[model samples]
Target: MQRVLSCFFALFLGLVPLASADVEVKAPDVLVRDVTNEVLEIVRKDRAIQAGDTQRVFGLVQDKVLPHFNFRRMTMLAVGRDWRNATPEQQGRLVDAFQTLLVRTYSNALTQYRDQVIEFRPVRQTAADTTVQVRTEVRQSGAQPIGIDYTLEKTEKGWKVFDVVVAGVSLVTNYRGSFGDEIRAGGIDGLIRSLEEKNRSLETPQGAK
Candidate 1:
């Protein structure tokens, strides 16, 4: 669970943007760094968020974080080949449930932020490149720095993140096994129910779960 949380948090932390990365190829890398920096400051200053206010944290994530992500793509990648097996309705539900699960799971983890510094590794991609990897490192107090990388694709609106890698673990790959198991046990609907139940548990008070 700790590992999963760390990976999820790393996804957001790695998604921030940097103001200095003005070039097109480096845009996503810069964008994620800047956004992460902005979010860290918000977490550092907002008392309500620090106190585990789910609404406040969710609002921040929905407004500031979701816009930069390609949730459908992430969901599909996480589902792997099984994505094609699901009906359109199931795919939609899976996307929604998965997104909610991530939002609920990682929003509270934001409060753990405490002066963690992010360092962006240099990116080398041409303007014509449609996909790229933006790499970074998170330096935390009393802990070894962890590597966080984003896999983003260029779109009409901007560069949007579809996958994340934390400490060499691929976010989509991390869930592949569990997702497969759920689908095997109860089909696509089962996976959706599992995710929905998990989200509900997160919404519940600690005493309930």
Candidate 2:
């Protein structure tokens, strides 16, 4: 009985970290350095970011970060099978909502920057001109290290991140099941409502920010 209980508790703790674990992500030399340095500078230099002006900070994210990411793919993945059901207009709305949610999320995350050190690894790219993986490590003061891996696809403009792996888990992949649950329950609209509620909570001053 005691052993079984202990095993269950251990499994729960593992899930805690696994669900939101900030793994030490490693990136390629120049790319990792450039990204970390840019974010760090924004944290240090941006007045609105320092002041917790999330609206403006998110505006910056729209300009700076969003351009580097692949929102269409991300949106499609998040919406899951609902994608097949939605009209083009509904799909567009879902994409916009998710993009806003992510931009605001990064803005908030950036505001929490105390001091994080990072190490970049070599870039292992594929022969095809379509994809590449950039890895990096985020070292904090006293917490377990976080690993971040960026999966990039080459576009006409430049490289765009389609997925970000925190620890070894893919962010989009992790969200899929939960998102699917919402889609199953409330459909795409339900998922949108949930995301809106979550974003609203972020706008409020409180926990785990």
TM-score of each: 0.88, 0.76
Name the weakest run of 10 consecutive residues (lDDT summed) in model 1. Answer: 16-25
The model with the greatest lDDT is 1
Tell me the RMSD of model 1 versus the true structure.
3.6
lDDT of 1: 0.77
Tens digit of per-residue lDDT, candidate 2, span 143-173: 7666676777766655567777777777677
Instruction: Please give the CA lDDT of all the candidate structures.
Output: 0.77, 0.60
**Model 2 Cα shift for residue 189 (angstroms):** 2.1
lDDT of 1 at 160: 82
